[model samples]
Target: MSKALRRTFVAATSLLALLAGASPALPTQGTFLAPIAEHHHDSSLMYGTSSNWSGYAATGGKFTSVSAEWVQPTVTCTKTDTWSAFWIGLDGDGSRTVEQIGTEADCSGGTPVYGSWYEMYPAYPAYFNNAVHPGDHFTASVTTTGNGVFNLTLRNVTRNWSRSIAKSLKSATLASAEVIAEAPSSSTGVLPLADFGTVGFTNAKVNGKSLGASNPSVIDMATKDGVTKATTSGITDGTAFSVTWKHS
Candidate 1:
């Protein structure tokens, strides 16, 4: 094979090896350099508003699982840098810890980029070295063993690729289960929201039950000053809903 073709073959082999747990984690790249943790705008809520998150969360339980499906939304990028992530996880509502995995659509130097990642909060996310694009169908889940062990899985059905990782986080409180579309954060604070139009999430489940049956709290993303950024629709069919971006 030519050098370029050989390099392509090597990368494809490496990604397969990594996804199958045959290879160790690689260095971070693309727009996934920093930790992406939940940054709440309203700490307490009847139905809350967050600076970074817009989705449904089931609280007041020992939430052992959360799973959802979404099509990666295409981002409309400008010269401005922005970030958005869709994920399902446990904790980070009333607890300090979060075990999450999902995909991101971002803007860098006026171009749109897509990627997948999993993170045990307080640590940086480990990205999956596979191509992701707008309109790729994805299903992701984060589940715990009721002890400290977790299983984080993401599958891109459109591309026929999947990754599942086993992890442990003793500090996780199992306080809440959530499926969220968020403007991911940096050390400074919540980053700008990407113009992702709208993303529909389906088959939302918590602990094997439909999320709508869990009395999930609906969250809308807004600024500290009360400027709305994204709006979440009511759950339908006991399993589906959508989040629409409203502002940066």
Candidate 2:
């Protein structure tokens, strides 16, 4: 096999080995990054609301690929630490695992912090070493061969940098695909959401078709007490939409 293909094969096999005996949260650079999904999500509410996620997710069918592009929103910070993420993935809408990658805007100790990360859910996210500032244009995608091998790719167009990881998840359900703006969680529960104003996403696609073609569910972030946090705009032209933040 050629060198590049050999590398991909090795990466895929290595991922299977990791997942076969995965830990709750793996240490990265001797530190654990918090997980992002709400484990107890009520998927029964397909077009329902979530406490931490706002965007579009298409379920009820097997998905092989998902992609979207967005401009990273800048966070307005306060004394409270808060976190927000924007991403595209193939699961975790109705299943346990999510293979996703995206950009992050956070308020760390009341200061603005920006970066990017990818997570194979059930494991802590592995952060990319590159810095991603606000306004960076990012295009990301997750694709699987419908058997196991998967590819996750992200590009910071404004920064002229890209990353692609070949991974394997033999037990992945591929239950759903989505592009989301989320309030990331810690060991406790959903953390405080950063004030990101708004993020615009375009060129959304699922399995090579426009995501709107799947009749995706539009989500709004809210609390069980009926407090709205962020809202998703209906997809326009089958490819574009926006999420506007409304709370902390």
lDDT tens readout by residue for model 1, 1-248: 02211000000000100122111222232354332445332323447677777888777778998999999999998998777888888887767677889888888778777788888875656777777889999999998888899999999999999999999898888888888898876556677898999999999999999999887778788887879999999899889999999999
The top-ranked prediction according to lDDT is: 1
Candidate 2 lDDT at 7 equals 6
Q: Name the lDDT value of residue 84 in candidate 2.
A: 85
lDDT of each: 0.77, 0.76
Q: Which ten residues in a row have the lowest lDDT in candidate 1?
A: 6-15
lDDT of 2 by residue, 11-130 (tens): 011111111222322222122234355433343444657777889888888999999999989889888878788999988866777789887777767777676778886655677767
The parts of candidate 1 lying over 4 Å away from their true place are 1-29, 33-35, 39-44
Identify the runs in model 2 with alpha carbons over 4 angstroms from their true place: 1-35, 38-46
- Tell me the TM-score of each prediction against the true structure: 0.85, 0.84
